[model samples]
Target: MKYRKFGKLDWQASALGFGAMRLQIIDGNHGNVDEIAVIKMMRYAIDHGVNYIDSAHGYHRGNSEIVIGKALQDGYRSKVKVATKLPCHVVNSTADFDRCLEEQMERLQTKQIDFYLLHHLNRLVWPKMVKLGIFKWADKAIADGRIAHFGFSFHDHYDLFKEIVDSYDNWTVAQIQYNFMDEEFQAGTRGLQYAYEKDLAVVIMEPLRGGRLTVPPENVAKIWEEAKIQRTPQEWGLRWVWNHPEVSVVLSGMSKMEQVVENVAFAAHSQPHNLTAEDLALIARVRDTYRAMGPIDCTGCRYCMPCPNGVEIPRIFGWYNEAVIHNSPQRLRSYYSDPNMLDKSERVENCIKCEICVEKCPQNLPIPELLDKAHAFLTAKG
Candidate 1:
């Protein structure tokens, strides 16, 4: 397995960290975990040199942590560093912090969480976390031996990411939803480099864009097929993120044994800044091709945000484009249906067709018409 310097932590972490968010389940039931399969695949990864296991309090509805506790048994716990998150969205008080940490510890069956991150941090939650004395709680956790290192998994604007990075000098690591498609999204490339410059280890999540990049449209795949060097779509996504030295380790939620094997093989060959000029050109072409396939030219610049009626116009369009361009209707449907994923206010059902967003949009994408199409496309049953 290939390894990278994980910031100032002085540890040689595998280039590919195991993400436990998408464990395979039985009959589509989130609670009915396929434990035997999960255990075998995870142990296979560990045996093959994946030393970092990332989980969260809410992943797989908290069963992920429970399974990790089971999978890391039989002396396997000593082989890897377990990372989990504090579900900051559920924090109603300062007591919730310790309560959740203790609960996660019990779930993981570990005394000290190697890496504990503040989950789903954004511009809205940072101040509340600070106001609730999160830094003090972290210091206490570290001093008490419950948390080995402090960090946050970000999902906010790049400026907010920099603000959070600058807020705490004790932050040892940070996780972001980064991939080939998200270079300019939340905490994009700029944020990745900023964190690295500050000496914080950048752990990448969604290196495959939640598996979106793995299955591209034929238009995009043809670009790869025409390239001199052949690689899996997954490899293209993984390598794009790993190519940057600013990144520390990438977290892929491997759900199958084959994926684990393939990813491990890719990690073996991934090196910082090693993708040649041709390789970069190929990726850029593929990205542009995929973008061209989308109906709207919305760059996700969020310029048309704050929809007067509280409609998340850009996000709605984003999901809409995914369903049409990538042919991922089922995933988008599930994603949109989950209230936890997006509020009802953000839904297209909330769009009042005020024509205000259309006027503000730089793409001039006929915002109302597109929202109608987005609503129709995403809501259609398969």
Candidate 2:
């Protein structure tokens, strides 16, 4: 495995980080992880030189850390740097920080977290975290040796990302969702470069856009085939992210043994600026093809945000676009309907035809009309 410089730290992190969010599960149950399989897959990746294992308090309904803890046993724990997140959403008080960290350490069966993150920092949670004294608690944790490094995973705009980075000078890492399709999405390319410039290790999540890029549409597939040096969609997506010298690691949540093997093989030869001009042109065509498949022209710029009726216009459009573009309507429909994925209050059903979003939209999209279509399609019964 290739190792890269981790921000300003002396340590080198593996190019491919093993994300434990999507470990094998039994009977399609999120909480019922196939422990034996997960352990084996994680161990395989570790054995193959993937030295970073990333997990979270809420991944796989909290069973991910347990399985990772099991996998790190038998002397494997010494071979890797374990990274996990504190569940920021559930912390209601200053004391809750220590409570959550203690619980997470217990679950991981580790006394020290090599890299600890404030999980899923967003608009609503950022202020609350500051008000509750997250930085003070983090300093205490680091000084005590419980946390080796401090970082955060983001899901907000680039401006907010910049503010957060500027707010903390001791930040060691910044994790963001990035891919060819999401260059303008949450914490996109601009944020990636900004964090790197600030000497923060940029760890990438959703490098394959949650596997949506792996299974390309017919037009997208054709674009890949057009390349003289052919590669899988997975390879293209991962290599695209790894091509950036600023990225320290690209995390993939492998659920199968083959995926572990394939990703490890890919990481072996991965390098920044590896792709040629032709390769890049082909990938751009593929990206354009996928974007063209979406019915909504929304760019996720958040210009039409703060809907008067609490409607998440961009998020709703994103779900609808993903459904149509990936040809996964049934799966996305279920996801759209899940209250955990998108709160019922924020769903498109709350749109009151205020035309406020329409006026704010740079795309000039018929905001209410599109919301009605999105509501009908997303809520449709199988």
Candidate 3:
């Protein structure tokens, strides 16, 4: 296991952190986490030098935390720094903050959460946090030994990410979704460099783009074959992220033991800026392959956002592309069933063909047409 400096703290975190969101489950039930399998995976990871474990109050509808708590038993708790999140979307009042934190502690069976974040921050929720005196509660929690460090996991634009980073002087870390295919997506390379310049440790989530990059289409496979070095698709995805010096830790929500083993092996030797010019060209080839198959060129700019009909245009197109590229109807169906998906009002079916978003879209993608295509694909799969 390779270790990296964790912000200004005295401890060093493993480059590979175990994300608890995709713990193995029984009968494909998200809520029914296989406790034995989770324990085995966690124990194996810890034994192999994964000292950082990330969880959340909303992962797997809160069952993720419970299973993580169960896995940390038998002295496994002392070997890792447990990171969890406060569900800011559910916060109605200052009291709600304490209530949520207490519930997380109970679920994790821990007194002090090593790393606690304001979950899923965007323009709308960041202001609400300030209005509700969330900073005060965080300070109080730190003072009372309930939270060791305070930060946020971001999903907003680069400018908003910078604003959130500059909002507090004590933000120890920030988490973002980063992978080979999403270099320009939410809190992209610019955001990562900005946070690093401010001395904030950047923890990466979705380093495999929620497992999409690990299972690429045939066109992408051809690019992989052109590479001089032989590596698994998973290794190719993680190595791309690990090549960046600004990334402090790469989190993989490994569901199988084989994934854990492969990831640990990759982390053991992956160094910053290690990719050669040829390697970068190979990644570009893979990206181009996907672009060829994609219908909408949406870059997730969110400039065309705040859809009058409340449609999450970029996300809908993203799922739609994944379904078509991977030919996985079951996976597409599961995405709609995700509890974290936006409400029906904001779903793809709600699009009213206003054409307002098309004017703002940089890609000039036919927004309504893509929404119709995504709706048809999802409905057919269902």
For each candidate in the order shown, give its overall lDDT on alpha carbons. Answer: 0.88, 0.89, 0.86
Q: What is the lDDT of residue 43 in candidate 3?
A: 92
> Who wins the TM-score comparison?
2
Q: Per-prediction TM-score, please?
A: 0.90, 0.93, 0.88
Candidate 2: tens digits of C-alpha lDDT, residues 116-227: 9999887667888999888888898999999999999998778889999999877999999999888988889999999999999999998998887888777778888888
Least accurate 10 contiguous residues by lDDT in model 1: 335-344
Q: After superposition, how far is residue 246 of candidate 3 from its true place, in Å?
A: 0.6
Per-residue CA lDDT of candidate 3, range 196-305, in tens? 99989999999987887887777788789888998878898898998998888899999999999889989987778878999999898888788668666766778788
Predicted candidate 3: what Cα RMSD to the true structure? 2.9
lDDT of 2 at 220: 78
RMSD of each: 2.4, 2.2, 2.9
Decide which is better by lDDT, 1 or 2.
Answer: 2
TM-score of 2: 0.93
Clashing pairs in 2: none
lDDT of 1: 0.88
